[model samples]
Target: MSKQNNYSYIGIAFIILVFGIIFVPRIIDRITKGDITRQESRSDYAEEKKAVDSKLSDLAFIESFGEKRKVPDFSFTNQHGKTITNKDFEGRVYVVEFFFTTCPTICPRMNVNLVKIQNEFKDFENFGVASFTINPDYDTPEVLKAYADNYGITNPNWHLMTGDKEAIYNLANKGFYIYAGENKDAEGGFEHSGNFALIDKNGFIRSRIEDGNPIVYYRGITSEDEQVNDEGEREQISILKEDIKKLLNE
Candidate 1:
């Protein structure tokens, strides 16, 4: 071929290279829908995923703050003269209250409410009820047993406990976060909380219900000068019944 023909071929090659550099990408983008801006469009699934992620974050935050508070370990004598301890309640859920058998006021109401709970949950093998007497000096195992009989409570899962005064008081005030102390000015010469505690299988104090409302732990006691009305007692027991079921299912 002549030199002029070779130059003509080189010019054609240069024109083709320039066009490919500028227009080839546009052509590919048109054919393949490869524009990055178009890929940023949102869909319902993406919105849903975002919402689910937000909910998960919120749940994580709640768990960080609401981790379970564990009940302290304890041992005491039950109504049947059996030695009961924290180990007996391991892997089980139970309700606990502080009371004496002979109290002329809240103790009777507390026992009646507890019997209601005992009857409601007696079928659940993992459920139990415990009443720790603040006046252990007078409430012996035999006395507790007699009190249990007076209530017609024969369920072995229900325990009326009596033990050292200080140990029982410590378990009430510190472990269960309830109040139990000697108050000469109070009814029956002793003061204790009317609120019932729901303990989980792992021994954590999961919930406390009083007066038909869920109250803060350790704050359900009637003051030495105050008395819990019958209406308040009934409401608390009703709330406690539902809370017990909730913890059991959990």
Candidate 2:
């Protein structure tokens, strides 16, 4: 029981503490995975975290472009001609998309997918769809009303909007960050992609899908003079449905 013995005891305790700190995680990992070390544990943790993050992602691929800010407010009208804006959705989850009625490639498919979702989410709460027509010049309130009816989208929750062309363009480019513009030769007043933007209740563009509009837009099969064809646009119906379900389920 001398000072030398006390010092020796303290040194052993410190070594044991360091050993546990270094090896406990590895030991636990080995017992679970059968062949992992501390490094492997760290790697596995990161990968698991990434996979989980990828599943319920609250991020969009557009973040890398230095444009991940919140979506801006703007005015538009639904199929019923009711006034609406991003501000109205400040407390609700919105699955937004950009399309023009004359698009022969993407709009039809996108509508069909949205219809499927509307049909599937009959009982979903607070979550809804907001499709902003790129061809504001032609997709007037009446045109959108008929369009929504044609697709059997009877849900009051769904909104097909058309407003000031320039403002819609701004929302497409600056707010939602999707493709939308005038195309004099494109059989419509404007054109846009089929990408669906999944926006959260907080006005954040959370995720994007690759599924384009339905093939219905490609009907008539005529390259003769001019027509709409969404075939070349991205197909994002599946992702749209999945993420919409996720947001509503939340």
Candidate 3:
């Protein structure tokens, strides 16, 4: 081939590469409807894709609930002093966390991370955050409202909930399968998991993120590990955000 022809070929190839770099991701984003490529690793993406695919089948309910775990029905008051019930979340995907307003340890960090999630999904009508306080006696509606105000949480979907202590404990331990109890040795006189539960539209627990590790619906079960560092907490938030997107798409 002529040197001039070779140079032309090289230039065409360069132009193609530039266009690919600039436009391919945009095309993908348009097709996917958003940037769903933020998953940390190829394995994470594969796992989430598998979950999404399986969720379309009849086996999804079984997969999401290994032993048919469903969050038991309950009525609780939110920061706005309005009643919220399990039935209210019937057709929505919600994130739940066990916490108290006066917690001096992991609760603050957990709340901060939750704000990240709340902001990310604030515009999605199907997405919500339900924060159930373990210390119901201390965290009344007024207290929760104040705490929500401090965090600048104005979203009506983000419910700072407080209700029957025993009911809350049972829901946390039995329904969500996370820790929540009174402990004299623990900070603020209460102990609870910093983990977040991702509940599907049908009231099944689809995923759980404690610290940085994520357990998806089809994956095998795992317990919450609270001894996580700051980096792990941040990673957990990232995983939570990705999983929420997956659930929303479902």
Candidate 4:
């Protein structure tokens, strides 16, 4: 072929290539985002999508309860004279912590976090917080009641419980997977962890939040561990709320 004819074929091919690059998308992205005509034409598709989203918005798929385990079932009296059973709380998410009313350190910090939780979901129904005192003999129902009142724990959702020491200790270990016992000489008198546990509607332990205060944050780990700023407590708190909301919504 002549050189001019060859050049002409090359030019035509380049033009075709440019056209393919630029105009193909116009054909391909016919259903692209924010397209006017496509949007109008596919209104039914959009409506169907919207219907799906709307159904999802209103869908409430509460989870089914699994095999019920015997979580340290014990009889404890609430701050009020109401004798309470753990079975009464079977279908709700409750935050449980262990601290003596006489605790002088992390217990206050723990209760502060607990009160924050209570205040957070104050208007929400079926969520409660309980702090079972290790020194239950000392932290009687009256003492717990007074402590609750003094702490401005006005919401009925918060409780400070007192029971037999052995029962409370066992519940602290088996139910919450924390340590609370009669070591009355530890810094805050009787010693226990500053661990915060979230129990779901079906009594499944969904998550645990560390106390996170540097002064009291060292309780939950091994003895050689050091406190770091990024041990996932913040994310755990967010997940805790999400799981609680999911349980409540269910």
How do the predictions measure up, each by TM-score?
Answer: 0.65, 0.61, 0.66, 0.61
lDDT of 3 by residue, 65-125 (tens): 3475577898999988999999888878888888888989778777777776788888899
Q: Model 4, residue 118: displacement in angstroms?
A: 0.8
lDDT of each: 0.73, 0.70, 0.76, 0.66
Choose the strongest candidate by lDDT.
3
**lDDT tens readout by residue for model 4, 1-250:** 9999999999999999999999988877864745877667699788988875653322122222443333456688889977777787787777777888877767776665556567778887689876788887778889998899877786676667887878888888866567877654677567777676666666655532336311211232211122222454332343445556765765
Ranking by lDDT: 3, 1, 2, 4
Model 1 accuracy (lDDT, Cα): 0.73
- Error (Å) of candidate 3 at residue 96 is 0.7
Model 4 regions more than 4 Å off = 1-70, 208-236
Top model by TM-score, which number? 3
- In model 1, the runs with Cα more than 4 Å from the true position are 1-67, 208-214, 217-234
The better candidate by TM-score, 2 or 4, is: 2
lDDT of 1 by residue, 108-144 (tens): 7667666767788878998987789999999999999
The order of the candidates by TM-score, greatest first, is 3, 1, 2, 4
Candidate 3, backbone clash total? 0
Which pairs of residues have clashing backbones in candidate 4? none
Candidate 2, residue 15: how far the Cα is off, in Å = 53
For model 3 the local lDDT of residue 130 reads 83
